[model samples]
Target: MSISFKKLIEPDSDLASVISQWENDPSIIPLTRPNQNQEELDHREEVTVEELMKRMEHHQIYLIYLDDQLVGEMNYMVDPSHLYKKETGTAWIGITIGEPVGRGKGVGYKAIQFLENEIKKQGLNRIELGVFEFNQTAHKLYSKMGYKEIGRIDQFTYWQGKMWTDIRMEKYFGSANNN
Candidate 1:
């Protein structure tokens, strides 16, 4: 099936249901935030939905769908004060696919492709993201997407009764001819 990205502002009932599922899914705890509890999840969901609506105003976040079914979500954050390096700008990214069947089906790579295109359209030179050491799946996917490991924080995250490092990955986007 063809997978595409759609920027979601106010989610419909179907999309809201998918976001709610993602918010409460235990699997996301390790991949997303180490310390997010139920209450925190509720608060985050509200804030995320609101932020996404605002992002739709600026076309910064997108909802992924496969054959019209909600598969995942991605957001690109470009802050000149932080992620921008010289004229080569960069974006901080976040993504999650709540459905199990979506995981190993190449959705991650497709999502990254969509984000990279959008970032390039915005004239950004690079994109970056941080994944917890425990998120091996995402690490592999990011590596597959040509994101190089630039740095790492050893034993920085404490969660799930253990500690894990945070790996910072970057993908440089030069001009079309150079890329």
Candidate 2:
């Protein structure tokens, strides 16, 4: 399955649904929401969509669509720290496909493919992502896409009276000479 990249807009029903599903997903919530209230779901969703719109206006976010449907979303941003400011043009990415049928298929891979193309198009040399330790499914996908775990934070989140780690992965775009 091919994935299309688009900008997310406010008042988009599909984006709303995706946000709702993501809120309820155990894997995503553990990382995105640590000690948040249940009532904050709707508010968080609204704010996130709004922020995505603002970032899109700045060329920092990209929404993923599968066959014209809003199945997932991803984005890239410049590395904030000065450590990677020299050689590595780091950009972050996040994705969540609400469709069950879209999970096992090649949709996620296609999204990553589009992400790579989009990052390179924006003149970025590397794409980075932070995945929760328990999100093995996403880890597999990123590994298959040539992403390597460059670092990991231990006990990054203390939520629900439990601790979890976040794995940071990075993928270099294009060959050595190009970057």
Candidate 3:
């Protein structure tokens, strides 16, 4: 099925409610949360819609649709590190297929393709994202899509009987590795 994107606004559209529900979802919590310290386990906490909007002021979220049905979401923001330095434009992206029916399909590939095209149109030459090391599935997906590892946050969490890290990956429009 073909996919499309629609701009997301909080506390207004019903589609926004889907995102609110995901904030505390057990499956989603593990995938999205990051523990910066071993002693502090952050479930990422649930936030009110207004709070979410405020916190995400610099970012934009788009509802992902498949045949007019909401399947997931796409989020992108100007890389904070690149805000003042404009030599090379960069954007960080996040994609989630919240609906179970959308998982194990090519939705992620399509979503990244669509998001990348949109980012390029906005004049960004670089795109980056972070994947938990334990989330090998997502890591492989990004790798398959041309995202190469730049570095990692290293050994912040222990999961599944092992210590895992946050892998930072990037895809640049021109000569990423050299850049």
lDDT of all predictions, in order shown? 0.72, 0.66, 0.74
Report the C-alpha lDDT of model 1 over 1-179, residue by residue, as the tens digit. 88988876565655666676786676775577544344443344533455446556644768888878877888887754433232345678888887877778888889988888888898877787788888888898899888888777676656666667889878876646233
Q: How many clashes in candidate 2? A: 0
lDDT measured at residue 165 in model 2 versus the true structure, 0 to 100: 80
Order candidates by lDDT, high to low: 3, 1, 2
Candidate that beats the other on TM-score, 1 or 3, i.e. the better one: 3
Lowest-lDDT window of 10 residues in candidate 1?
A: 79-88
TM-score of 1: 0.79
Which one is best on TM-score?
3
Residues 1-179, model 3: lDDT tens digits: 76788776655535446776765565765576665443334344445667657746977778788878888888789866633233456788888888877888788888899889888888888887888887888999999988888877777565554567888888888554435
Residue pairs with colliding backbones in model 2 are none
Per-residue alpha-carbon lDDT of candidate 2 for residues 51-147, written as tens digits (9 for 90 to 100): 5456666445566666677666665567645222234676777666766656677887887787788778878787777787877888988998888
Alpha-carbon runs more than 4 Å astray in model 1: 12-14, 34-51, 54-59, 80-88, 175-179
Q: How would the candidate models be sorted by TM-score, starting from the highest?
A: 3, 1, 2
